[model samples]
Target: MKWLNKNRVLKVIFFALVVKPLVFIILGLNVRGKNNLPTKGPAIIAANHNSHLDTLVLMSLYPLSLLYKIRPVAAADYFLSNKYRAWFALNIIGIIPIERQRRVRKTELFSGCHTALDNDEILIIFPEGSRGQPEQISRIKKGLYHIVHDRKKTAIIPVLMHGLGKALPKGEALLVPFNCDVVIAPEMAEFQTADDFVKQLESCYQELKTYCITTTEQHN
Candidate 1:
């Protein structure tokens, strides 16, 4: 696992040469409010999960200088199931694996997240806990709530992604060329309760989705 973190050069090369071009040029990604992302980090990017493309699309919004600092939280059961996938997730994509099952200790989970934020890195967490239908945002799980509760100072950036599920839906191997849009909202720093925060986050996703649809129709 240590070697994986040391392979920063490989990660940059892969994202710059492969992921960026494939997502931006080949797939035709349309991103709005990218400047909403903070110049510095130690922040959390909470987004709705749909497809594998969501991670790549979100990471593309950041500049290369901050690329290495971006650490996505991925399901350990899936990404670390085998050596090949583990290497790809850890080294290539630079993901921080979290055990989705109940077997993982709570202390360990919080520790990993704390370490990342303490390092002033960006953490991309999908609060849905798993993938859902395209454009359909699910109820956020408690993991994000706990993270925020523990790390009070971290800024939360709400992001909504559209068209990723159609491009590469669940259980599909091949990716269809499609236009994907990512809408980033302004940062929220205060929350009264976990439930309230989650509710507001879901609302943000829906609002962004509507904005995407209206913008698309107007252009057409």
Candidate 2:
């Protein structure tokens, strides 16, 4: 039973594919731009983090089999433990441990990420190193830039989650029952050293934000 306590992937899969979608159906969760998702190999998706619900929404939109290839990079300190949630987080979704509190070799992460890209897998990255307050985003780190910059061959997609912050705020376990939006968009690419890289990166967030606003307007 020791190991059982550490493995929750099966349950998570059920929840993500079954229970959560059912919840969305019953509650009518709004998600758009799924067609923007690359249908084939080796891509990177960068998104903002607002709630635990963010991962579920993103993964659900990705095709089922590719779900197997998607690895979510999460904070090591928060998700690493002897507990079942920790085990599933580490083994199931393939966690990339990020030591935010300490200054570590940044290149190590890039090497691992590069290897994953070369393997033609999808990686989900939260640019905000730390989850921020409602309607707010933490300063995005360079990890995303480094990964996409180095692996130019891989498709890089920008995603934005809307209204999830109000549904579930930071530092709170209460997941309020409410509808949210997942805005998917086209692949954005630029040269590594291009001066427009910064604008391109910010453009991803801006597009997501715009999608959210437009969705809100349409619904109303």
Which candidate tops lDDT?
Answer: 1
* lDDT of each candidate versus the true structure: 0.81, 0.69
Over the stretch 41-127, how does candidate 1's per-residue lDDT look in tens digits? 799898888899899988877777678889899988999999999999987788988977756567677677788889888999999
* Per-residue C-alpha lDDT of model 2 across residues 109-179, encoded as one tens digit per residue: 46667777777878788887666876666666667776676555788777877777766667888766667
> Candidate 1 has what TM-score?
0.90
- Candidate 1: count the clashes: 0
Q: What TM-score does candidate 2 reach?
A: 0.81
- The root-mean-square deviation over C-alpha atoms between each candidate and the true structure, in angstroms, is 3.7, 4.8
In Å, residue 196's CA in model 2 sits off its true spot by: 3.8
User: TM-score of every model?
Assistant: 0.90, 0.81
Residue-level lDDT for 57 in candidate 2: 68
The lowest-lDDT stretch of 10 consecutive residues in candidate 1 is 211-220
Clashing residue pairs found in predicted model 1 = none
Candidate 2 C-alpha RMSD relative to the actual structure: 4.8
